[model samples]
Target chain A: MMHQQFQDCIDACNACADACDNCAAACLQEGHASEMARCIALNMDCAQVCRLSAALMARGSQFAAALCRVCADICRACAEECGKHSMDHCQRCAEACRRCADACARMAAA
Target chain B: MMHQQFQDCIDACNACADACDNCAAACLQEGHASEMARCIALNMDCAQVCRLSAALMARGSQFAAALCRVCADICRACAEECGKHSMDHCQRCAEACRRCADACARMAAA
Candidate 1:
């Protein structure tokens, strides 16, 4: 079982991963796929890292703190990129990424 | 777009994640959920790292190789654990994990 302190971060990471996955799929459906390339790419990266960080924390891995640090950085970057877009999916993804980033930062600090 | 060299590994990662998710969900539905706790936990961890490794490779990140090394280790462990179970979901998940581990190993060596 994961430590109680990491539960919120884990939840945030899972939520962000889901949001990012949805955002990437939505971006692919948009008319201007080329325009959303970076967003899609970042979404994929962010989603992966969020999931990995969450799992590491759940397992109580020694590298969880370091992984969370990197996860937070990627989440921040993804959020910034998503914030630039006007699509509803992107907006939602940005919000999720911000929340995950904050949670990951706290986890890293702990 | 990801480099052609990493495409197979990315596909394997995605497939493995799907399999792991299915396996975990199926494990929960079984009569002995407590008995499958380790399997479920490993599935979650394996799924997360596989996604992360795939994204890192897709982005051509400098850390992709190193990450893949760890991912391969986790995938191997997950596969071994899943293989010990008799359920169809576990069998399929074990296969996927093995494939992912192989792909990750190749990626890491590259």
Candidate 2:
């Protein structure tokens, strides 16, 4: 089944999406929210792309790999941006995004 | 502010995404899943795009309108595809997709 075939990537993506969403929301609540704008934007992008990549992979869609490439790009950008922030949420999100980017890159190559 | 500006479209997108995900899962459980392949694919695509559109609009991203345009196109396709099915899930998904498509279109234009 598709789930079995892409379990690791799906799990990674799911985690990353959640992390991105949470980080974005937390960034909004930060005292220096204006400075977190780019991080928030990238987080939103990463979350959406990760969700889409996971869904496509779960269905064994041929376009999954292509989307994975896009997701990886977004995840990496999000991770880098989040890494610049000192907030706990941002730190955690950076880790998740890195993991997801790696997973997505592997999936895209697979 | 972003939420207030895109409230209706965002709500429609969220509802349609839930409906699409449910329809896809239901289709997979159906006895003739092969026959429902297109429906499932469209559902997944619509769900991801809607989620992405909602997130972008929520952030007041400059790209929100462009993504909403794509979301509207996908929603319209998904609605038409789901409308051909007689299953209750499909019917519900079709209605949700139509509403989302309209909402996204309005958001895109605005």
Instruction: Identify the candidate with maximal DockQ.
Output: 2
* TM-score per candidate: 0.60, 0.61
Estimate the TM-score for candidate 1.
Answer: 0.60
Candidate 2 residues lying further than 4 Å off, grouped into runs, are: B1-34, B50-110
Residues forming the 10-long window of minimal summed lDDT in candidate 1 chain B? B61-70
Instruction: Report, for candidate 1, the interface RMSD.
Output: 3.3
Clashes of each: 0, 0
- The sequence of per-residue lDDT tens digits that candidate 1 reaches over residues A1-110 is 53777899999999999999999999999789899988888888888788778878888765577678778888898999999999899999999999999999998898
The C-alpha local distance difference test score for the whole of candidate 1 amounts to 0.87
Per residue, candidate 2 scores C-alpha lDDT tens digits across A1-110 of 53697999999999999999999999998678899999988888888888878888888875677678767877888999999988999999999999999999999899
lDDT (Cα atoms) of all candidates against the true structure: 0.87, 0.88
Off by over 4 Å in 1: A1-51, A58-110
